[model samples]
Target: MLYITGTPIGNLDDMSYRAVSTLAAVDEILCEDTRTTRKLTNHFEITTPLRSYHDFNKETATEEIIEELKAGKSFALVTDAGMPVISDPGFELVSRLQDESLDYTVIPAASAFTMALVASGIPSYEFTYFGFLPKSNQKRQEKLTEILHHRKTAVIYESPHRMKQLLKDLVKFDPKRLVSISREITKKFEQHERKTANELLHMMDKEIPLKGEFVVIIEGYEEETVNFTGTAKDHVSELVNEGMRPKDAIKLVSELRGMKKQHVYDEFHK
Candidate 1:
């Protein structure tokens, strides 16, 4: 049996009893970083042997680990922090495990994005978790555009260094949109600042510190009430007639009416 466990994101006290005992019982522990997991194991007095299993060695490690599992070795998979397979190295292994008919289960624990969202006070009834944005400018802009047009609250993870750039992009796309910036979650310097995109942009260096991991919660798009008397296609055509590009017009109509861009595009083009 493979146990996919959750480790504390920050404060060590958040480690659950089951997680500790399971780690202690496992024959071997597969970790992204042995040095980091070492601290946790040492604190709990768990002597389970740890083997490196990260993105670099994932392909080869998966095959070896699967054979060990076939030989009845019970191993526990863990990331440096939080749950495994969540923007971490476990999805491929899990998929391979399923293919091999191997049994595995997850041990639930805190997630930074979920914690940030709850602390954000944003509308959480509906949400979309976008683990991390693309690094390239063009790809990132396309992703930001998708988020801007989405009707559901969006959650994203970002590195400390890129936080400022992300805020600037948000401000450029939609300054008035409300956003919650959470940093160092569950840590000593943890903070959650709620403000408009533009406000946060201006306060980036002045108020918000550029340190630790960040979870950005963007409020869902609110439909704008426009006094337009026409069908959806007609609305798209009307915007295009007013000097807007066809694609831009479609995007605008979709956001304003809370409809999918493809639906609007199809109607307009037909």
Candidate 2:
């Protein structure tokens, strides 16, 4: 059996009894960081031997670990924080396990993305998780463009140092886009701020301590409604000047361009 157990993101108390038992019962534990896992095991008095299996060694180490499992030695997999295979390792193992008909199950624990989303006060009914944006300016801007248009909330992980730069980029594109910045997941200083991109950037400059990992949840675009009273003519003329019929212009502008038709009509009339 291959147990994919989750470790605490920050608060040690988040470790569940099942998680402790699974690690203790397994013949060996494959971890991203042996030292980090060692401390967790020591706290719970789990005696399972540790083996390093991380991003660098995942391809080769996974095969060796699988052979051990097939040999009747149960094993547990864990990362430094949260769940494995979630912006982390275990994808390769999961795919291979499914192909070979292996036994595996997940023991879930605290997740930074979900926690940050929930804490954000952002609508959680539907959301897209983009683990992290590309470091390049071109790729990052491309991602930001889609993220701005995306309807549901977007969750992304960013490093401490890059967070400020990321926020600056966001503000440059859309100052009014709301966002939630969360850090230190379950620790004493665990904090989250809900505000627009500009607001969040200012808050970070003022409040955040400049350390710890960050999870950013950005709100989707929602255009504000404008009263169609008299602006309809001007709006219509504006679209028509841009080469569109009064009706199609209003419809197109309102439906796609985010300008109300009545407002367009009022504008044209004027």
Candidate 3:
């Protein structure tokens, strides 16, 4: 059986007893970084041999691990922090294991996004977790636009260096949109600051220090009443007249009026 384990994001005390036992008992431990995992193992007195299984070597490591599992050897997969296969390595291995009817169980522990959501005091009843944005500027902006369209809370994991740039992009879209920034989670200097994009941009370096990994929780897009004199079909026609594609116009009308896309399409065609 393979074990999918979760490690403490920062605080070692957050490690679960089951996770410790699983790591200790496994024939071998596969980790993103042996050095990072060593700290945890040393603290818990778990001497399971750690093998590198990161993004760089996941393909080959996965095949080798699968063979070992097939040979009746148990292994535990862990990331440097938090849960495995969540914006981290181990997903492909798990999928392959499923195909081969290999058994695996999760040893759940703390996650930065969940911790940030609770700390942010945002409505967590409905939310989306976007682990990390694209590194390229164009792709990142495109993703930001998608996030702007979502009406539920959105959570994003960002590094300290990019935090300011992210806030600047948010300010460009919706200056007054409420957002919560949580950093250094489970650590002594942890912080959760709630403010608007514009406000937060200004507060950077002044109130919020860029030191550790950041989890940004953005409030849902608040739909404002858009006054228009015509029906949905007419709205689509106007946008179409303005050189928008029929399909694009239909989508725009549906989004703007909070109506179903099919309903708008039918009205536009009628």
Candidate 4:
């Protein structure tokens, strides 16, 4: 049997009893970083040996792990922090285990996103978890635009180094949008700041620390009821006549009409 366990995101005390016992019982533990996992194991006095299984060695490690599983060796998979397969490794191995008809169980524990979301005080009725934005500036902007248009709350992970840039992009896309920035969750110096995108940009260097992993929770776009009677093209043309650029006009009309920008652009251009 394979155990997919969740480790603490920051606070070591968050580790579950079942998770600790499972790790102790397993013949071997697969870890994203053996050195990191070793600290946890040492703290709990767990003697289970750990083997490296990260993105760099995933392909080769999966084959070897599967063979061991075939030979009736039980193993527990864990990431450096939080749940395995959640913005972390373990998906590929889980898929292979399923294909081979191997049994596996998840030992549930704290997840950073969930902690951040609940702490954010944002509407939790419905939300979309966007693990992390693309590294490229263009791709990141496109994703921010897409998130801006999302009707439900959105959650995203980002590193400290890029936090300021992300805040700037958010301000550029929609300055008034509400956001919650959380960092060092469950740690002694953990912090959460709720503010508008524009406010966050101003607070970036002055107030917010750029020192730890961050979770950004953005409030959803609230649609307004605009009583424009003209067709989409007519609305676009009117905006363009009112000094708005054609592309900007199309975007505004699309948002007002709850239609795709590309569709509005095509209609206006044609």
Candidate with top TM-score is 3
Stretches of candidate 1 exceeding 4 Å from the true structure: 225-270
| Total clashing pairs for each candidate | 0, 17, 0, 0
Residue lDDT tens for model 3, 1-270: 999999999999899889989999999999988999999999999989999999999998889888989999999989999988989988899899999999999999888999999999889999999999988876676577667657789999999899999998788768888899999998999999998899999999889998899999999876562245679888877655544567876886798788999999998888
TM-scores of the candidates in the order shown: 0.85, 0.81, 0.86, 0.86
lDDT of each: 0.89, 0.81, 0.87, 0.87
If candidate 1 were superposed on the true structure by all CA atoms, what would the RMSD be? Answer: 4.1
Model 1 per-residue lDDT tens digits across residues 1-270? 999999999999999999999999999999999999999999999999999999999999999999999999999999999989889999999999999999999998898999999999899999999999988766676677667667799999999899888887777657888999999999999999999988888888678888889999999876551256788999877655544567877888887878999999889888
lDDT of 4 by residue, 1-270 (tens): 899999999999999999999999999999988889999999999999999999999999999999999999999999999999998888999999999998999999889999999999999999999999988765666566667667799999999899888888777657888999999999999999999989988888678878889999999876551245668999877655544557766876787688999999888878
Q: For residues 26-133, could you state the per-residue lDDT of candidate 2 as single tens digits?
A: 889989889999999999999899999889999998888778778888889899999988988889998888988989999999888999998999889999999988
Candidate 4, residue 38: Cα displacement in angstroms equals 0.9
Order the numbered candidates by lDDT, best leading.
1, 3, 4, 2
User: Which candidate do you rate higher for lDDT, 2 or 3?
Assistant: 3
* Model 4 ranges with Cα > 4 A deviation: 225-269
Specify the poorest-scoring 10-residue window by lDDT in model 4. Answer: 221-230
In model 3, pairs of residues that clash are none
